[model samples]
Target chain A: MAEAVAGCVRHGLPAIGLWRQNVAEQGLDETVRLVKDAGLRVSSLCRGGFLTAPDFEADNRRAIDEAAALEAACLVMVVGGLPGVVPGEPLGEISRDLPAARERVAEALALLAPYAAERGVRLALEPLHPVYCADRAVLSTLGQALDLAAPYAPETVGVVIDTFHVWWDPQVFEQIGRAGREGRIASYQVCDFLSPLPDVLLGRGMMGDGVIDFGPLTGAVAAAGYAGDVEVEIFNADVWAADPDEVVATMKNRFERLVVTRV
Target chain B: MAEAVAGCVRHGLPAIGLWRQNVAEQGLDETVRLVKDAGLRVSSLCRGGFLTAPDFEADNRRAIDEAAALEAACLVMVVGGLPGVVPGEPLGEISRDLPAARERVAEALALLAPYAAERGVRLALEPLHPVYCADRAVLSTLGQALDLAAPYAPETVGVVIDTFHVWWDPQVFEQIGRAGREGRIASYQVCDFLSPLPDVLLGRGMMGDGVIDFGPLTGAVAAAGYAGDVEVEIFNADVWAADPDEVVATMKNRFERLVVTRV
Candidate 1:
């Protein structure tokens, strides 16, 4: 976490998105102090959802408190896929009731929205791609995410527009417009979807490195009234193995060439 | 193809879906003779569309003729994905315009629907899973396929409801209902979507082995008034490598246990 903060400073990057694990490893207070000392803004806390888990409420409460302490824009929420799917455990008799799983997410939000609002932390719901619907996230489209967030105040609950997750959606552009109209566009994340992927979870590519044409997506976000810092979120194995400095430099260059000009 | 017909007869299965490659290798007329002699029905032809390819028109017209000769229910259409993607070739400079790729499908249907109708064959547009949106088929949702079919007569243009493709869609049930109303449910293909897929193209599971609950989906099909023969379309390497007799027996058992009872 300290190295990430220092890297942001060294690379002249203005902000960073902090994952909860990294935050925990460095200790929340120390991590906050490091980012503050480095004069780097916290873009958003990495996550706070996984509503299907046993200790969801307590864990999410702590996540909200951390986001509040960091003064991040919003806490990214990755609503869990299925019930009783513990990390590192062998997947057992899986529940096939997707609608019921989604209902759990809605119920979780109803309970958490007020608490998050009190803490001034918006829960940013991210709709992962449908490929991840069985194992990673049940929310598979921005439209569905918007529907889930409808009951809460837009200030308390918002939806994320991540290119890698949503580029294949038929209704993505229209959903972005709806998000703008509802004032629920919380964060804009960019990454390309590379095919012949080595690993499904870690197959995201840097901007302009794959098949996504950024001009139209960025244009949609801009037209939808999103005036926020765009974040790069690549999880490719090759990218992670590369030198961090080079990765940072490449992402910035790609973002400028492929995203910024269009936006 | 002859062996498949013999196996279907030996297994007491009444019908079979034939792929073009197998038919080509066996000689189309010989395939027709073989199935006829074996007293088996042809549920549907495996494929017909690749609208973005250079020889699509000629190739698809031939596929329609083959389906007609085999007396198949529909000519399944797997619309081409991005333009200029050739099989077994290194992918290079892919066209990222998905909307445009979809428009090409629409245009191709407009041209072929009349021809197919005249030949007493329905062009069944199979909306492949969105995971294949980049390389296999641009038609990723039944709704999109329905929209493309709206211009033609319902008997002439129809959409396929493949479980592996449309199961994850948020609006799948509603769209299935809509397809029923439109009289566009040409075929019902079943295969489970297994996680940690070995090869995305060939990772389909047998019905009872994966996370899909056959009850609601089969119930939906029955409610939607589809009385077509349900086809098994597993593409798994293990299933392919297993003894054909054992594979057929397992599929029959699973179908009875998981799908037929539900319906």
Candidate 2:
């Protein structure tokens, strides 16, 4: 973890996103001190939105605290799918009440929004691809996330516009425009959507490794007035197998060529 | 093909869906004659909607004619995804012009609709799940199918309401009602949606085996006045490996308990 902070600092990367597990693994305070001392901005905390989980309330409360402690821009929330969810396990619904499940998210948001506001942390609701609708996240589109955010102040509840999740949606550009109009675009996460890929949990490819024309999407994000950190959030097995140094180098290369170069 | 028709007759199953390939295998006229002789009804012909295919025109015309010849109620269509699709192959794109690919479907329907109408066939458009969006059907919602069908007569371009394909949709019930009100529900296909299942070609489960709450969805379709054939279109490997008689028997049991008995 310290090496990651050192690497980011050495490489002149101004920001790095933090996964809570990684933070916990390194001792949250220690990890925070390292990144803070190394002059790195925590773009966002990994996640805090399994609203359907049994321990959702306590878990999310801590997530907010951790994100606030790190002074992260936001805590990305994957408002989880069916209650009884385990990756690779057969999708068994504890309740086939999808609307109620969604209601739980809004309901949870209402409870957590004030708490997040108190802690000076924003809840970044990410709309996962619809393929993950059954098991990962029920929120499946930027527009829907914006709708969920409408009840709260934009700062309290904003949407994360991940390129991989929204690229397939025809309404994406229009929704991004709406997000801009509504002041709801919080984090602009970058990834690629290679096809023939199922909604396997760890199936994301690097920016240029897929068929996504990141040009228009990134353009839309920039046009949306999003001047924030663009996190390279690839989750492929091959990428994971590669040396961390190599992955970092490749990520920087792709971000430059595919995202920043366009900018 | 003959055995399937014979089995349907012996079991007194009212109608059987036919794949175009099976029709071709049996000699189209011979299969048509066999079904006609057995005093059977052809509920629907399997498909005719690879609108992105170069030869989609002549192929769909032949499909329309075959459905007409079989006296089928509708010619089910899986509007082909990404131009030049070959299922199970790496998701290749002839062009990443998804909108243009969809436009092609509208254009092809414009050409095929009149011919289908002339042959007394309804074009049943099936919206496969969004997971199949890249390489299968871009039409991922019943509403979208209906939208496409709107520019043509409802009788000429009708939308299919398949339970498995649409169960995850937040707007499914509303869309089904809309499909019914528009009088565009040409087919009401039923199956299960057990997730953790990737978007593999034959990954579908039987009616009762999945997480799908058939009660509400089936009730919604029934409420929407869908008095059409309820086809069980499972593509699971385990089910396929079972004895043919056992499969049929289990299907009947599930169909009665989960779908038919609901009525």
Over the stretch B130-170, how does candidate 1's per-residue lDDT look in tens digits? Answer: 77777778888889889889888989998899999988899
User: What tens-digit string does per-residue lDDT give for candidate 1 at A113-211?
Assistant: 999999999999999988878777889999999999999899999999999899888888899999999999999999987765545678689887666
List model 2 lDDT by residue over B43-130, tens digit each: 8998898888888898899999999999998999998877855666665445666777888888988999999989889999999887
Q: What's the CA RMSD for each of the models?
A: 1.5, 2.1
Q: Give the winner by TM-score.
A: 1
TM-score of chain B of 1: 0.96
Best candidate, lDDT:
1
The local lDDT score (0 to 100) that residue B112 gets in candidate 2 is: 91
Model 1: how many Å of interface RMSD? 2.5
Clashing residue pairs for model 2: B81-B136
| lDDT by residue (tens digit), candidate 2, A132-192 | 7767888987878999999988888899999878776767889999999899888998887
